[model samples]
Target chain A: MESSRYANPYQTGFLLGLLLVATIYVTGRGLGASGVFKSVVTTTVEAVAPEHAANQPFYQAVVSKHPGASPLKAWLVFEAIGLVIGAFISGLVSHRLTFKTECPPHVPTKVRWIAALFGGACFGIGAMLARGCTSGAALSGMAVLSVGGITTMIAIFGSAYLVAYPFRRLWIGGKQS
Target chain B: MMGPFVPDIITDQLNLIVGFLTGLGFGFLLEQAGFSSSRKLTGLFYGTDFTVLRVFFTAGITAVFGVIILTSLGLLDRNVIYVNPTFLYPAIVGGAIMGVGFVVGGFCPGTAFCGSAIGKIDAMFFVLGGLLGVFLFAEVFPSISDFYRSGAYGDLTLDQWLHINPGLIALGFTVIAVAAFIITARIEKSVNPDAPVYSFPTKSHAAFAVAAIALGVVVSVIPDRQTRLLERATSVAYQQQHPVERIDPQDLALRILDRDNDIQLIDVRPDAKPGDRLPDALTIAVEDMFGKGWEHELAATKKKIFYADDTKPAIEAATLARILGYRNIAVLDGGLSKFKAEVLEVPAPDHPLSFEEQMVYDFRLASAEKIKKLIAEGGKKVVKKRKIKKVQGGCGL
Candidate 1:
């Protein structure tokens, strides 16, 4: 079955840019995605292994900075929640809501899942290393032209490009997803 | 009064409310922009779709221009805003990892959430993986917290680092984003020739580019915030100057009674109803302090003292005298009421006083004689701290 076409990239991008301006204008901070993940991880760790979370300097920092609030009480967490709701609503309205693995036809579903898991693990470590994920560091950083952000963006894209050739079969196989 | 109503003026429950609302907008926009699709997002890297690049660059450019405009308008203070501090090692290494995640998972943290929301199981895995990643990082943080905290530059903005005008950088960005858009559109066409060609209006592009640059130019041209505020407010403050500096009544009486020819009392209220004032005190209007007519008279006076009623008179008087280069100026410790309580209203010393108390009384009595003499010899005086001679007679012995 043929899937519906997406919006014009440039037009959507322009609108997104305006939204970003509003984000920073009101919040004095740029949009972030991975930070929420970090918070969630910290929360989970705290709940599952309180001693470990308390002992770790990394968890300690996030925990101590906020004295009387859950790690999930973070802005990024709320934003992510809103994001999911928004995407869900949009997907439902656009008929894009489906439970399926989107990958090259020739690339086995298991292989795709494996690749996804590996990628997610790599991203998780890297995002923490950079103190933000793509949304936080790369996009938000570039909003203010931060060196860290620009550098991270280059690293992510550059590394991805460096590895893309090796993983070409996963994407441009006999049939594209 | 203006927005950015979050951390600046509204910092309590309102912050979260605004944040949540902003999130709603962000989520809605991201979904509408089709960012919920990992294939669409990863298409940029694979050369099938350039949506990610277009959206990111557009957002970045728009945000930069918006910030410049807001800061220039004085609605936003660039100083108070939070710009992410650069941590060099973490950013690069972490970004590379996240990039790998993007390719394999086909989602970043934000897009993964969106995708999961849209019932994409792959997106859900990506989110779970992100959690794993963050957890791993935290577990290892004690080992590498130093690395995490490395490259410690505090909230460094690009404008300050590059030493270029923000306006110029903004203009430069507009040129680059437009150029990149055109080039990328071409690349997309060449890579997928069978793909539909969607062109934006050239005039709109030109108008947008022009508008962005125009905003930059306008902000760069305006003077800074402080000079603007001070220039607008100082004259008004001067016009509303009606205040006094109070002197301690006892201190004033002591100084006056000491014939501290060093001190000159001046009654410089806006409207001096001069019936009962300090002995030998001169009466003058507030305007006379700055008047060229009283410049010589003020200059000749050594200690220009006033038992002030409000601070405005002292501030105005001091400002004027400073301009005229008179250094020795003061207001009494307390005003006339304190003076009366300490001196004129004192009951006669009926009880046998201690030796120290008697000496204090003698010193005050002597000062009174000196001040009475000075007041009699015209109101000219020098202001100086009093020196009471040490008592020779024993206390404990």
Candidate 2:
């Protein structure tokens, strides 16, 4: 099916850039996506295992900063909510809002899903290690031309290209040539 | 009065609530653009999907331009915004590590939250991994504490470092974004030649137009608030110049004999009749404060103002002095009624203190000496106490 879900990369990028500006103008801060996830994880970990959360320095930081309230109370969380709603609406309009495994033509569907899970885990750990993910590092970083952000963007894109060949089987799909 | 409304008016708790609400909107927008999928985010690497690159670059440029404009027009203070510092080793190492993580994990922290919100189970696990990652970082924080704090530069903006106007920098960034857009579009087309080209109108285009109008309005209105605040300051400067007049009882008594030292007692009361002048005083009634050309009279003579009714006349005198920009305005310690009480009405002591009041005054003087000693020594109070006693009292205290 022809999906209205996809957008022109340049146009979308420009739109996102505008949104970033709006966020900073009104809020005096840049857009942050990973921080929301960090808050969510911190809050959930704290709730499910308070002792464990307290023992960990990261969770403790979140807890101390938000003594009376949940760590989930953050600008990133609200922005993330908007992101999902907007994406969903876009997907629905494009007829791309469906549950299915998206993978390379050659790869088995289950393997693709497994790869997605593992990939997601690595992204989570890496974002925490770097203090930001793509949105924070590459986008917001380049906005201000922060050296680290530019460096991270280059490293991420460079590394992806360098390693894409090895991981080609997971994406290219079909029986191996 | 102008900026940071939420934190200024409310408690910090509300700040958190505002942060969360703003974040929800951010995440929802990101997810709608298909940022939740690892394949989508990683497309930039393989030349297949460039959505991440496009959206992010656009957003950053838009923000940079908006900030520059707002700051230039004086509608916003750029200093109030946050700018990330550039760290050499850590950022590089950490970024390299995160790059690997991005490919393997697919969802960045933000996208993961967005993914999870829409019932993506993988996102939940991704978030779990992020928690563990942060925990690990914290546990090892002590060893790396020096490294994290090693970068000594405090909050430097790019404009200062680069020695360029921020507006120019923003323009350069916009040029770069536009260039990248062109190149990425070419790459995207070449990579997926068979796919149908998709286009969507940008939401921010409309938002920017609205922003420009709003900023224009704020720029025009700010001067008015500044002018009003300045006017209030100028009026206060005028009152300090005028001093109040004094009525000498000796002069009044001597006025009966027409002595050479008879006081020139000018009356400032407003209710005096045309023929109701005092035996030794000239009348300048209170109601004549503004209407009877006191401005010229006060300006011409350096005589202090005196009145009999109450502090009301003194206040009026001060107010007039302020408006007339007088610098020597002063008030009588007591009005004419008090003068009469002291001179003709009574033979009482000027003051009477109770025993407790005297004791309190003495105590205050002694404490003042102790405070003076403390101040002279730079006020470093070193309390000496036994360590074990403090430990024993800790449980109860």
Identify the leading candidate in terms of TM-score: 1
lDDT of 2 by residue, B65-125 (tens): 6565555443544444455555555555666666666665566667766665555655566
Q: How well is each residue in A73-116 modelled by candidate 1, as lDDT tens digits?
A: 77676677777777777777778878887776787888777777
* Consecutive 10-residue window with the lowest summed lDDT within model 2 chain B: B388-397
Quantify all predictions' global Cα lDDT against the true fold: 0.66, 0.54
Q: After superposing candidate 1, which stretches have Cα over 4 Å from the reference?
A: A1-4, A175-177, B7-11, B194-203, B213-397
lDDT of 2 at A111: 66
- Cα lDDT, model 2, residue B213: 41
Cα lDDT tens digits for candidate 1, B125-243: 77777777777777777787777778877566677888867767777777787787677677778877554345345567667767766766665666544444334323546534622
> Best candidate per lDDT, number?
1
